[model samples]
Target: NAGVIQTPRHKVTGKGQEATLWCEPISGHSAVFWYRQTIVQGLEFLTYFRNQAPIDDSGMPKERFSAQMPNQSHSTLKIQSTQPQDSAVYLCASSLGAEVFFGKGTRLTVV
Candidate 1:
């Protein structure tokens, strides 16, 4: 298996632009998670999907941040109205029971 695949290892967008990060989980995995990492925040859980269904998103911002698992193979994290504060490394992970695999992550930079 290719493990979890995240496209465009890095992204750069202007403030107010939108950035969408993509993730492809391992085959048959039932759970996926999104996290954001920053110098101050360390790693913060953003959202989670179980069986391609959204289960939690309490850590996500109230506006301009959203995550979707459209199918068993992939998920997407969208960030709109990008700001300098939004610049961080977005990580994707998938799990089967106890074992988990993670992608390289997408580093988003807003200018």
Candidate 2:
């Protein structure tokens, strides 16, 4: 599919381990967003950037969570020392204007 691509549809990590999720946005999109979905929080915005520059990351944890858009084609979200509470469906979305396209997301499970 020509939509956003997120690698490793499902991921399992042990407690205190590390997990890295990858995302490739649609070509020509200038804005990218990272979000986390869970039964408790629903969908929560984690961070976003435009033109590969970080815009806002207010929802991200002050520690152990980070995201980066190193280039136009892709972005990565890394979680260090993952805990069971960190388990969620991480979503990646890209937008050129008001319309945003989303990937299937990477379901992370921390045991």
Candidate 3:
């Protein structure tokens, strides 16, 4: 498919464990965006990168959340010492111009 691909559609982790989510953007896209969705907060922007360079990550948690784009084809989001509060559907999107394409997302559940 032409859409972004997110791995492990569902994940279960123990409290204090680490969780890493993977995303592969569309082949020629220049920008990738990461977001978190939960019942309390509807779709919150976490971070984004343009040309594989991080632009902003203000919405990302300072302590445990981290994102990286090692190359143009893919990006990753890692959450260290995951907590119950960190449970949410993490979305990955890629854009070329005005329209953005999104993946099914990785659902993280911390217990």
Clash pairs of candidate 1? none
For model 2, the run of ten residues with the poorest summed lDDT: 1-10
Clash tally, candidates in order: 0, 0, 0
**Cα lDDT, all candidates:** 0.94, 0.97, 0.97
Backbone clashes in model 3, listed as residue pairs? none
Write model 2 residue lDDT over 38-102, tens digit each, in one string: 99999999999999999999999979999999999999999999999999999999999999899
Residues 46-84, candidate 1, lDDT per residue (tens digit)? 999999989999999979999998889999999999999
After aligning candidate 2 to the native by TM-score, how far in Å is the CA of 17 from where it should be?
Answer: 0.7
lDDT measured at residue 82 in model 1 versus the true structure, 0 to 100 = 97
Per-candidate TM-scores read 0.97, 0.98, 0.98
Off by over 4 Å in 2: none
How would you encode candidate 3's per-residue C-alpha lDDT over 60-96 as one tens digit per residue?
9999999999999899999999999999999999999
Compute the lDDT of residue 73 as modeled in candidate 3: 89
In TM-score terms, candidate 2 sits at: 0.98
Ten residues in sequence with the least summed lDDT for candidate 3: 1-10
